[model samples]
Target: MRRPLLSEALLDTIRSRAGGYDASNTFPHEDLADLTAAGYLRAFVPVERGGAGLTLREVAREQMRLAAAAPATALAVNMHLVVTGLAAIQADRGETALDFVLDDAARGEVYAFGNSEAGNDLVMFDSRTRAEPQADGSYRYTGTKIFTSLSPVWTRLATFGRDDTDPDAPLLVHAVVARDAEGIEVLDDWDVLGMRATQSCTTVLTGVRAPADRVHRRLPAGPSGDLFMFSLFAAFEILLAAVYTGIGRRAVELGVAASHRRTSMKNGGRTYAQDPDIRWKVAEAAIVQDGVEIQVESLARDVDELVDHGPLWFPKLVGIKVRAVEGARYVVDQALRVSGGASYGSSGELGRLYRDVLAGIFHPSDEESAHATVANAYLGPLER
Candidate 1:
């Protein structure tokens, strides 16, 4: 694997500040600045665009490494990476629609994903936001978006909405809106149980404007079969799974360390590492974490190699995400068990990890959606 851009010292600083950030309900500005200085934000852009030119698979490995240092920071950075990755994926496939993103990244502009909305079950297929077309060929987007990661620092937000102005082209309009532009408001309300350092606040768009030139795609509303959708799903799911896998790996390591340190009074001063039950629990967590790691690497490699699985691709991608998330939860639980009651303190590292792992359940390709996608792949569509 290629060397990671984030150094151990930088990662340690980020990790050290994570608890304070979470406690204060603040964003990790220092961590972001360090990462930006490292040019980690442009890792997905082509080398010609002044980036590291890393492939999706390589970037996934890097993300996993970063997550092990600080999961919330990794999760927040994942949004920017996903948007840039989508642009890279399309550009590599001969699409000029997202060239502006590459150009902007090369110029050191930060991007954020503002695609999520409350109660939008169709996900990328449709939208609850309204996209009103202008006479000058621009668009006005109006809606509220939830979980807007990097809310405080993004220079541009890649957003989407529905445009039913043209009957034949009832479209899902995609565009990039400037962060400081009119009609955009980032509410300071991001308190949560975990991943608090992300500061994914609620963003209200009264009528944010995107110039005609900034608009990229206008797919027919509802479950698009376009390259944009493919890139979005593939990059988002794989990168997300990588984060959880890293969390699981960290949890296993912590469990082992705790076992080696704690002594078993009942066993005549023997350490917990010599206790059968503690050893079993640690082994169980390791086994599950290893499985998730392998799956993350495999699917990421498939994406980079363009290995065609056809209809099975979506199921496989979603399946890997679900497996990674659920596996992380289980592994973390077992680790806590092996580490004993000391891990239960809310301020402890293990305690924070438990909270961070729970946020995985809320990410895209959720448990229900993943299972449905897999079922549809093997059993065909349900009868209407």
Candidate 2:
């Protein structure tokens, strides 16, 4: 049998720390340190680059396991993985532009996603941030990015902004900026209902410069069929699905255990596990969870194997993400129901899972967007 990416002892340690991190609404600093020491941050970098050299599918599985233990930590680390995974994928296709990302990550640099902007529905295609081209080829970015995960200790931020220097030809300039770069501000505004340990704060860039060497792609704005875009969607959606799937798996496990542990007053003091209604609910949750797990694994494997779904790629990616997140949400809800009032306590694991799972709904390729993508792929663009 293959060695596990995250050993049981390490998982237990991380899991034990999760509640404290959540309760304090603090970043999982210790969890990050442990994962980094284990070389988990470099999972997608090439072996030659001093990394574990794990495949996307392998990393996806590991992420699922990690998320089950400490979801906020996993979700925060997902940003770094997505950046390295994109670089690794590009390198596999003989593109060396993003090799620096892989190199930096392998050398202990933490990368975070800083592309999400308020009111910008055209994610990855356009940006509310302005990227002004400099004479020396570097670009100065100025904008506010919301949900900037790994905000506390990221060394680098993978972000983008629109460069509209020419009125007729606007471009989306993708680049990575050092966290300590001038004019960059991290706001402590990430107190949300769930995923509290992530501390995904707001970032304000006031003419923060991304040096020329770090500027990777400058593509036409408004959704192009670019490989970079495809890589981003693939890495992001698949890994996100993995995290939520792990939550679902944990929910099912908790629900099962809760059923066996809780005794019913009306059923001759028998455990809830012996109740027909509880059994049916658990079975339903498990069934949905099983399907989500299969979908996440299958899609991730296809990405690793370089399966060419072409036009179907976006639809498939979004489909799995939507399914995994929504499925996990349903499973968590069912698990809460199965566990009853005790599970509703703030300190309850089920309650934490319920809150954390809700953050999934806000991730990209949301239900409305996913349905539109699938519809456009199968039915063609609606009369537009």
Candidate 3:
């Protein structure tokens, strides 16, 4: 009897506006406003802090529902959720280091993940950006981050850079930089093939100063078993999987509806739902979508319940992300196939879904890296 996170009317409004936003290649400012008014931005902040206090699992389910309505909006919001969710998770476990993040979110500040670099394959483990220590304890970062979602309106950007000041003890400095801080430039160069509403523009940082207090962690250049790292991976991977799973679910629904609406010429104008081949395609897509949904929900639940997977945590996280993304891609492709030639049109919902789902592969834990992580976890490192 619990109420839905996104009401049907709000979802319908968001869905109706999606095509216009995607077609115009503009950020969904209206969608953001609507979501913000619904308190979606602070879903993870503790209720005592004037927020929803939703668990990660609840938020993940909400994200799936949002993505089904407007994927770009959902994906962009996912970045903010990742930051806030990380802080909430850490705080829930008695770590107060990131309590400021939750506080800021509760106070109406928006955050974005500005950690992605153009050529850095190591992801959170390493950074191509340079972090120089200042006379005080603060650090100045200089580098460019690509695919920075919520670029247009994010107030704080969570990013990291490498500090080689001490070559023998190099560190990856993680910090949250205020968007209006001096020496930070957000470029309007987000033109892309998909996820147009994300406005994930390129961010150029030239000595952007992060006050010492805002600088969170300084871990070694490579992977480390830090709580912050675990929180980040858990929130990011699970929520990201949720978004793609939602996309696959929507695609399956679209395919089924299309089958019922389209008539087959060869069978006396009978609906495609009567065509065995179309039905089979719909069934196949539904099966894959079902598995992806289950995997995402299960992983989110485990994280919420604090299930001890130990070393397998990373493998499980990356595995679900890869599976959900790939499965979504397949489901969208199948949906496009069964929807007939009209779906090939640029304005068609399936066409947009097809484009948006492609952005999944480009997210962190790419297929190559996910495989390598799993391989190392199972077979051990390759002879050092």
Most accurate candidate by lDDT:
3
RMSD of each: 1.2, 0.9, 1.0
Show where candidate 1 strays beyond 4 Å.
167-169
Predicted candidate 2 versus true structure: per-residue lDDT over 1-384, tens digit per residue: 147768999999999999999999999999998998898998998888899999888998999999999889999999999999988877877789999999999889999999988898877878899999999999999999999999999999999999999969999999999988999999989889999999899999999999999999999988677889888999999999999999999999999999999999999999999999999999999999999988888898888888999899999999999999999999999999999899999987889999999999899988898999999999999894
Model 2 pairs whose backbones collide = none
**Residue lDDT tens for model 3, 1-384:** 146567889999999999999999999999999999999998999989989889988999898899999999999999999999999878877889899999999999999999999878898888899999998899999999999999999999999999999999899999999988999999999888889999999999999999999999999999888999999999999999999988998999999999999998899999999999988999999999999898888888888888899999999999999999999999999998899999999998899999999999999899999999999999999884
lDDT of 1 by residue, 181-273 (tens): 899999999889999988899999989999999988989987655888888899899999999888898899899999999998899999999
lDDT of 3: 0.93
Q: What TM value does model 2 have?
A: 0.99
Looking at model 2, which ten-residue stretch has the lowest summed lDDT?
A: 1-10
For model 3, the superposed segments whose C-alpha errors exceed 4 Å read: none
Using TM-score as the yardstick, the better of models 1 and 3 is: 3
